[model samples]
Target: MKQKDLIAVFDNDRDLVKAIGTLKENNIPVKDVWTPFPVHDVLKMLGRESRLPYFSVAAGVGAVIVTFAFLYYTAVIDYPIRYGGKPYFAFPSFVVIIFLLTILLTFISTVIVFQVRTGLFPGKEAEVPVTGTTDDKFVISVGSKEGLADEIITEAQVILSANGAVEITEQER
Candidate 1:
């Protein structure tokens, strides 16, 4: 089933934090937060683990393993070719190929993983819940549930305004 969502925009990290704190303090459920650049203490404010770095590490490891395996299989088993008196399974020479392959694989894999995880990819229309959120602004989104969207939107508007937010707007989808 398609899920409905609400997006609320804020002007800065300070206001964003205050809005989030108020929501949590009042037992509101925030689905996610979006910002263009890193915000100090934002994760702590939201009580969220940093998943992007973990995903990057995993992608790097996978890239290394895949590069090593492909080079190993091609050089030692599939079609061994000796050159310059070096052994068919020359480990030193393989280093260059492995390193290059690892870098390429890592970059591509990381981008793909990030896109999938964040629902951002080519051909997908960009969703800027709040235009300013990507430029010195912050956004908080709450999933729409039965009989709760209006309440959440209202509370968010009030909390954001009270916290010095320059502007607040509710977006429905």
Candidate 2:
């Protein structure tokens, strides 16, 4: 089922935030939000806690474990060498390589995850983006046509307008 994105435009940040609160209170899930600048209260109202940080930590840990296993197997068993009084399993020398690999992998993985989750991947065009959302206006985008009834959309528009949405536009995703 294809989904549609509905954009509700507000003339000011206050109105946008109020509309967001109204939608949430009424159980109309906000799909996305856009503003000229950061608005902590608006995000708080949305209540969507990000899982990106947790994902980064997990990826970092996984990278470290894999790097350790690789280094350990190679240095301690596969090709053991006693050089300059250092034993076959010299933990000190492996630290630099492990640290570098972990950092690199974590960075790469985090970027991939961010792009995938945010729909910012290369070649993917914007779906129902509202121009000037980065300048004079604030926007609250809602709607995913799949199972989103017309009555619900109508209700959402009414709620948004009642709360101060100046304009509402519907577009396909």
Candidate 3:
């Protein structure tokens, strides 16, 4: 889908950071940035905190709880069976399944969460201003509303190019 966003592309990381700083100084809110690799400085510039770790922890804990509950309800309440003189509600017997399912479910949930949160999925095209972003280019985008409409986008493009942006473009969502 097309998005109405003003994107400033920079050939180098330094240029991107500089453009971002300029935009911030001018009181422009950045929508997002795209880079070939993780840029720690960009995160600092954007003032965004990492949430993936917490999401991961939550996924793991949820998986363990669900697996344990399912196993206990099934083995201890649904149907009971004795094997090798072991208790029907043997805790040890559920360890392997719990461990394996926890890991598997955690991984699955993490991936699903990431994809859902990031708007990424199979066969969906990403909304980007330009190509080559995943190779060596960096892009800084500002949304086109909230006082940052066409006129603001024009101002942004001028500031970006002057501050070292290589290519600038606007898209409509």
Candidate 4:
């Protein structure tokens, strides 16, 4: 299925953010934003939040608990050891390994989650919506669906130009 999109290109992040705000104020839906670098303000304005941090935290905690449990079971129940009058379940010794394993598991889980969520895998090419987006340009795209009114597009273009869009073009995808 082919879709029509109105793209507003900005030379800087400030203009892009400002244009997005204006479009929001006018109730124009912004489909996506492309920038050379991560724009925290733009992500907030778009209400885009990542679950990676949350998943990492959970993974770390789970790793710690599981690591501790496995150590305890092996040392105390599975194989009892009495060396140098030390206790079978030595918590002090477990600390270092537990911390290391937690970091390792958390990192692995975070990477896996990120890759899965982003659809990034081997032999897959990324889709670039507009040119110069990965350079210094910022792009704001508004999607046009079936029965979309031309008046809305015109209004959006007016808003984009007024808010410092360097160029506004229509593209079919």
On lDDT, the candidate that comes out on top is: 4
What ranges in model 4 sit over 4 Å off?
1-3, 144-147
Off by over 4 Å in 3: 1-6, 48-50, 147-159, 169-173
Tens-place lDDT per residue, model 1, 82-160, is: 8799898889987888788778877887777778877886799767776776687788886545535566667766765
Say which prediction, candidate 1 or candidate 2, comes out ahead on lDDT. Answer: 2
Q: Return the TM-score for candidate 3, rounded to 2 decimals.
A: 0.76
Local distance difference test, each candidate:
0.74, 0.85, 0.84, 0.88
Q: Model 4 Cα displacement at 16 (Å)? A: 0.6
For candidate 3, the lDDT comes to 0.84
The reply for model 2, stretches above 4 Å from the true place, is 1-6, 11-14, 36-47, 142-159, 169-173
Q: lDDT: which is higher, 1 or 3?
A: 3
TM-score of every prediction relative to native:
0.72, 0.73, 0.76, 0.93
Would you give me the overall lDDT of model 2? 0.85
- Pitting candidate 1 against candidate 3, the one with the higher TM-score is 3
Give the distance in Å from residue 125's predicted Cα in candidate 4 to where it truly belongs: 1.1
Give the per-residue lDDT of model 2 (tens digit) for 24-89: 887887888888888889767876667889999999999999999999999888998889999988
Candidate 4 per-residue lDDT over residues 1-173, each given as its tens digit: 56668988999999999999999898888988999999999999989967689899999999999999999998899998988799998789889999999999899989998999999998997677766999889999987456235788899999999999988998876
Error of 1 at 96 (Å): 1.7
* Clash total of candidate 4: 0
Against the true structure, whose TM-score is highest? 4
